[model samples]
Target: MVNGDDNNARITNGNLAEVGQFPYQAGLNVSFGNSSTTWCGGTLISHRWIVTAAHCLDGAESVHVYLGATNISDVTEPGQRHFIVDQSGIIVHANWTKSTVTNDISLIKLPRLIAYSQTIRAAILPRLVNGSYSLYEQQTAYASGWGRDSDSSDSVSPVLRYVAMPVMPHILCRMYWSGAVSEKMICMSTSSGKSTCHGDSGGPLVYRDGNSSYLIGTTSFGTSMGCEVGFPAVFTRITSYLEWIREHIPDLP
Candidate 1:
């Protein structure tokens, strides 16, 4: 979904809701000077850090982050100011692949620590040490973005859109992808047309375990069939990369 006005030009089959409007949703816009280039989805994992897909960065510098915003067109609010990332400390997964979407996670360190607020904060990362994640069958997860709503369209959404899907069994997912789906990936989808899309890359796939919302995955890729046909949507499992994430940001739990 596109997050700004219709005239902004870029479009896809994804959607986005305003920041702070949804606790599990966050807006990710990459702006170079006066013009906003591309819009990807992200999850606020801390007061200052955001977790997204590495392919979204694609070796760009001097990016601005917008928090506490409901609409990309409207950024005049007090808490919705853009912050510059500390380029020196930025880290993208060393094994990230451009051809295939593997190890697609990256972290952005803000120059200054963001003050905790209702509109901006971190989401919990799933625990890697947890006994087992395969015990559940009906595990539901949420994904938000501003990409296209369907495969046929390029027009992005003005407001963020969300969809709930069930986690696909690892065995089934691996079988479909010829075991390409690794330990670092999480698969999700529905039997109907309900799932994330092309521009939803880097967005969070969140699920609730016990009392907290855990970021289980980051939107990566899916088949050309789009969100239909129950094709598994792949994501970078946050739990699999917890050590790498924490090594860069020691304060994150």
Candidate 2:
């Protein structure tokens, strides 16, 4: 179930005013109990570690994580709780290719620890593991979820939408995804129509450095037809997986 249109529009909880105002926003609402679903975009790099995608937990099972809440039914209570019981069953990316989108990436190990409030913190990885980030570099990238703003209906979005893309040029996104765009991938867009559609798969593509906010990428797919003009919204290049994400989350800093 992934359907919600108007080009997936509904991210207005302060409308991204140049990406400042932070108030706790990390995500995950994946389900697999009723009959197939989606929305697994995460980031909260530590406090118990979380970084998502791996095909949204591939088969799925009791996976429910909803922090802070831009409005996911106001998130019930329990101090904006947390849970990650998916064990480590689907740790993909040995050169992953379920059809081809290269190593979709995943990691969830959170049974407890996320208590960082100010919203709820943790997100800052990419302090120059290598170099190069200049597509003019105006820098202002953030992505939130509750996926499916469009792609003809799978229904998932109670409220929690965000988009501020701008960070393009991986050879112009491989000239519009020719050769399926890879080099570990990283590109963003938004002619003001805002993006990150189709259940915002494994979300979190942040960037904002003077106050702190850096998760490199993970939303991972795009071009279902429209986020507006010629498609463009791909990710999963968290510094080319920084040493395989510190050799499979060895307490990533």
Candidate 3:
């Protein structure tokens, strides 16, 4: 969903994102009950693999990834390109629990290798030494998705959305959620009124360093109250699970 006020923050809001701006962004289309569809955001880590949140996979069926997509729900819209590709496996962390939402990271395996392009490519993963990410206080990052623009209506944006995420101290962030925030997670929000909402789960929280953009975390969960209230959004830190990820996808780097 779009995170900020469109009237003032239109330039940085998710609703106006250009096509292929984020080459690694992945859009998920899953079967719901009979005909309904649910979408979740993720990032391509390799031609055959995706990294996302564990919660988004619960009860998912007929899953597909809209690769190289910017306008996910648009078919006739020009200047946009996408491919609804088949997915074979949905892998969740063994330690993931719905109750605590810990170990919320997960992976998706595609049956065939994807064709890379400017609009479709794998994401960069950081090399964490000794389990600590080198993020500093107040560091700003980027997150993209096609989640809701507002909870007023349960709708996902047709175009990809994004926001600048300012890293908040875990200790400071804990105050917003009654200490439910964990070390395995990172908390972020934008003073410009940007925050990740529904449908954004499993999306990548990116940090741009020089010419490279690294997938630093995966969207996990947020306050139960709702998404538009500026509550600190939580993410599963990738640095903590670098070993596990490497074990599963040996050639991820």
Best by lDDT: 3
Global lDDT of each candidate:
0.67, 0.64, 0.73
Segments in model 3 whose C-alpha atoms lie over 4 Å from true places: 1-15, 32-36, 76-88, 129-132
How much lDDT does candidate 1 score? 0.67
For model 1, the stretches where C-alpha displacement exceeds 4 angstroms are: 1-21, 31-36, 77-79, 128-137, 209-211
Indicate the residue-level lDDT of 21 in model 2: 34
Model 1 alpha-carbon miss at residue 36, Å: 9.3
For candidate 1, the per-residue lDDT at 130 reads 55
Q: Report clashes for each candidate as comma-separated counts.
A: 25, 13, 5
Q: Tens-digit lDDT track for model 2 on 45-106?
A: 77777778777775567477766555566657334665656645335556656466677777
How many collisions between residues are there in candidate 3?
5
Candidate 1 local lDDT, 30-133, one digit each (tens): 64444446667778887778888887765655556766665656667655657666456457788988666678888877777777676766778765355754
Model 1 RMSD in angstroms: 5.1
Sort the candidates on TM-score, descending order.
3, 1, 2
TM-score of 1: 0.82
Please rank every candidate by lDDT, starting with the best. 3, 1, 2
lDDT of 1 at 58: 58
Q: State residue 8's C-alpha deviation in candidate 1, in Å.
A: 17
Q: What is the lDDT of residue 157 in candidate 3?
A: 80
lDDT of 2 at 5: 25
